[model samples]
Target: MTDSTKYLQALEEFILLGKSAPGAAAVANIQKCISSPNCFVFAELLELPNVQALVNDAEHKKWVEALKLFAYGSYMDYKQQKSAASDSLPDLTDLQLTKLKQLSLITIASTEPHRLTYPSLQSLLDIPTTRLLEDLIISAVYASLLDAKLDTANQRVEVSSTAGRDVAPGDISNMIAALEGWSASCSSVLTEIEAQIASIQASAVAQRKEQLAYEKLVEEKRKTAEKDGSKGKRVMDHSDNTGFGLGEDEMDLDDGPFDDQGGARKSRKGGNKMFSRKR
Candidate 1:
């Protein structure tokens, strides 16, 4: 298996065996495990029933409570627990103090919005002075636990982002469910977009087909009109040629089949004879 699997297996064995066989070795191993970079492992170990049993045992009580503070509790929890205890707690090493400060920031981030006031954060961390708190925040920022801006004028810390932590037991399923929901939402939007594109494409194709059909009809009408116009022009030309000759023949018939001078003389003689007969 992978290194993570091996580490987890090793951690599980330690937690299970350490409960039945509590000693300097087990406490040392526990200390080593909590000091690991993986904060979730420390959190997971804190949740064990056997680990909680260490609270009653005077030898490992301080370590158990310290681990709890790193897991989910803030500096306030550490202070409060220390106040209630009859015995004196062990002094925190430099490394443990740094880790506690980091964990305390995480706890604060969980409750507050992006902007966190210096006073409130100082109260939670129980730092002696503002300078120390600022230093702690700076260190946490350097460790990449938080992305924050210290607004001295406003006396607030503005957090823009935070790094992801390890998943607690049974949290993986919830994370998967959230991811599946997001994927489904994205798929739905994609489907709607695809449908809209198909609709637009269909409309364009129909319009193109209609335009082609109209153009074809117009072309056919133009050809038919040209043929009809040519036929009508030929008929008009033939009628004009025939009408010129026929019109002259009709004019000659109207003149009574005589030359122009002879017709006039005969018409005059006919008029004289009619006059004599009347007399």
Candidate 2:
């Protein structure tokens, strides 16, 4: 049967029990707890004003315990209570039984890790056989209470995920505190990463500047060397031209009639040339 239908039926049973006010209040509280995130019906049921009001009343005490068991208590809890006092325990209908099993599965998921063995589940569910336990788990999976894998070979159920339930009192505060801590940790990590990146970038910039300076220095040295080479070549050329001019002048003075005696030598040479022409 659908959960809503079962709930309505339970509500009607409560009304028939002559405790409509508290019964409806309890059921409403259960519904609210089931709908809220991370909330459990067990403690929430106990905390209900109506349920609490029934606690001291000898006549309605059974109904309060019944609501608690119906909303959250497991078959084991029921069994234990029945062992203690059978007459005090409320009889569970088939729908309520199914709901109890489903809620028990949710509790298991919340309290335990991913993988659960068949024997362990049997202990938790108080089921008679492995088949019944597997059937219950399968039903829960089909109802979308759990995302799981049934390993028949290994005799275990691997729960991959589960939905969140209503939050209990103080649960929100605890969650907020945990989230704040996580946020602080993330902020610290990000700060460290940013600092490291900044350091690397600065180092890279410094290295690039150093490389550019070195290149500029080499270029300047190259230009200076070229300038010095050109100057040396010009000086050597001038020296070679001066040596050649001096040698040519000495050769002309020694071979020709022109001596070191200034214009007299030049005039004597001209007269000799004229006499030779007349002869």
Q: What lDDT score is found at residue 205 in candidate 2?
A: 100
RMSD to truth, every model: 8.3, 8.7
Alpha-carbon runs more than 4 Å astray in model 1: 1-22, 29-58, 76-95, 128-130, 153-156, 170-177, 214-279
Candidate 2 ranges beyond 4 A from true positions: 1-53, 65-89, 170-177, 218-279
lDDT for each of the candidates?
0.67, 0.64
Q: How many angstroms is residue 178 displaced in model 1 relative to the true structure, after the best TM-score fit? A: 3.6
lDDT of candidate 1 over 30-75, digit per residue (tens): 6766565443335556666667767788888777766655655666
lDDT of 1 at 34: 59
- Per-prediction TM-score: 0.55, 0.58
Model 1 residue 136 CA deviation in Å: 2.1
For candidate 1, the 10 contiguous residues with the lowest summed lDDT are 270-279
Candidate 2: clashing pairs of residues: 36-165, 36-166, 37-165, 37-166, 37-167, 38-165, 38-166, 39-165, 39-166, 39-167
Clashing pairs in 1: none
The backbone clash count of each candidate, in order, is 0, 10
